[model samples]
Target: MSGHGFHVHGPHDHAVEHAAHGSDKFSGNIAVMTAILATVGAMFGYQGGATQNDAALFKNNAAIDKTEAANRWNYYQAKSNKQNLAELAMTLPGADAERYKADVARYKTEKDGIKKDAEKWEASSAEWNQKSDAAMHQHHQWALATTAEQIAISLAAITLLTHKKWLQYTAYGVAAAGIGLGAFAWLHVDPIGALALKLGMGAAGH
Candidate 1:
């Protein structure tokens, strides 16, 4: 058959080869990106979860303080009632009149101390409630920002996978996400989580 002097392989072969190479590269890139994303996501999720726990713990502590204050106040009231009964008993003409008076005096002293302690605990509980609220607010903000940043990273990663030519844009997006995550970790999670983790480690060691 008469044909062009330059004999070449079919164009389809080259196209297929090119596509195969591109697919391999894309697959490798996807694996690497998935690993990175998973790691970052876990870190972010753990931080968010820990902060939520801290907020819960703070709330629980505040509740405990309030319960303690209430108990102390109840104890004071009961002691005051007992003191009044002792004073009544002291008025009776009996050999134990002096002992009854002494008992009443003791009850009065204990009731006074309990009243002061209850007041202190009341004030302390109020302060703890305020602190717990502030911690909850801070944790909520951190969780929100971290969640947004993770979403942005995931979206950017998907965009990059779809459009390889936009690799540069994805790099910038990744850097921004990293910065945001670092800031969130440092400000919110690190402080509280580190302490809890340390205590956990200590307990585990034992």
Candidate 2:
């Protein structure tokens, strides 16, 4: 009978291999989490930027409407004041009474036309205000939704980094809640709603 010597590798190598495998698994998990976070962040950023641009546009439109309204009002007021002054001058027993009367007639004609135009602009101003307000409100809602989504995504990323399962689940739940809220806001306050308000206001001559 011949006996063969048996040798076994030490446990150190096995322990090292186990640790290496565990590290690889952890790295893979982190990579997946990072990719998800990046994708969500990008989406939120895009929506946020769009909302901001829309808000700016609405503000600019409102400003323009207000300026036009003011100008129209001022023109009417100036015309009225000038007509009054001309009448007062005519009564002053001055050498240029005939000239004053002619000036008064001219002013009256010009003022009548300006009055009609002012009324039209006033109606337009009211319509514009309604439309701009609606648009601004919609943009604000979109901004809020984007902000909520951003917060949820950030929380999820933090949970993933810390390997907190419960926290991660909570983060997902919050994200779902945010999505629902965003949907509700969009439904209630949208650009279509703004456009409809504008059309209705115009038809009503507001």
Candidate 3:
């Protein structure tokens, strides 16, 4: 889902070596493998789409919370200015001195409540940030999984073309990795995301 907003781009292009179908060394076997790959590939693709959608939803929610927090802080600042003004007005010598002092006390109490509300909104924003990060991490996992699936499908085609046992085994290995990555995404295990974060931080230092 990554480069821009909520919509996800398609998976990367895979270089598959297709074999000619008419009895060209186990074409029937190739057909079966292709069918199986098609099914699994569809499932992985759907999961990737779902992951991207979830990530977008979280990002949107985080934006909402951030905006609300900003508004709350603005309100807090207005209240603070009012409290300061009331305090300053209390210094004037008049029959209204007591009234100005009362206003000062009221403003101070109202400012305290505003401060709490601002802090609560800030905390809410932080929570939303965490959620958005988590969703993005899951999206990365799904992207990796989908890439692996594509590679596996390519390898399966190449295996049929060359009839190499090792190549078939490698295809299976890639497919297993795809399944594992998909599980990581769904389970919210964040090894790949953590590694990316670490690498990004390291690069920024340079």
Task: Name the best candidate (by lDDT).
Answer: 3
* TM-score for each candidate, following the candidate numbering: 0.56, 0.56, 0.77
Give the TM-score comparing model 3 with the true structure, all chains together.
Answer: 0.77
Q: Please provide, for model 2 over 67-118, each residue's C-alpha lDDT reduced to its tens digit, 9 standing for 90 to 100.
A: 7767877887898899899889988854588888898898889888877877
Cα lDDT tens digits for candidate 3, 66-102: 7877887788788778878877877876647788778
Q: Which candidate wins on TM-score? A: 3
Give me the runs in candidate 3 sitting further than 4 Å from their true place.
Answer: 1-30, 192-206
- Give the per-residue lDDT digits (tens) of candidate 1, residues 13-41: 33333344665665455445544544555
Model 3: which ten-residue window has the lowest total lDDT? 9-18
RMSD of each: 15.2, 14.8, 7.9
Instruction: State in Å the error of residue 157, model 1.
Output: 4.0
Off by over 4 Å in 1: 1-37, 85-104, 120-131, 161-178, 181-185, 188-206
lDDT-sorted candidate list, best first: 3, 1, 2
lDDT of 2 at 41: 45
lDDT of 2: 0.63
Clashing pairs in 3: none
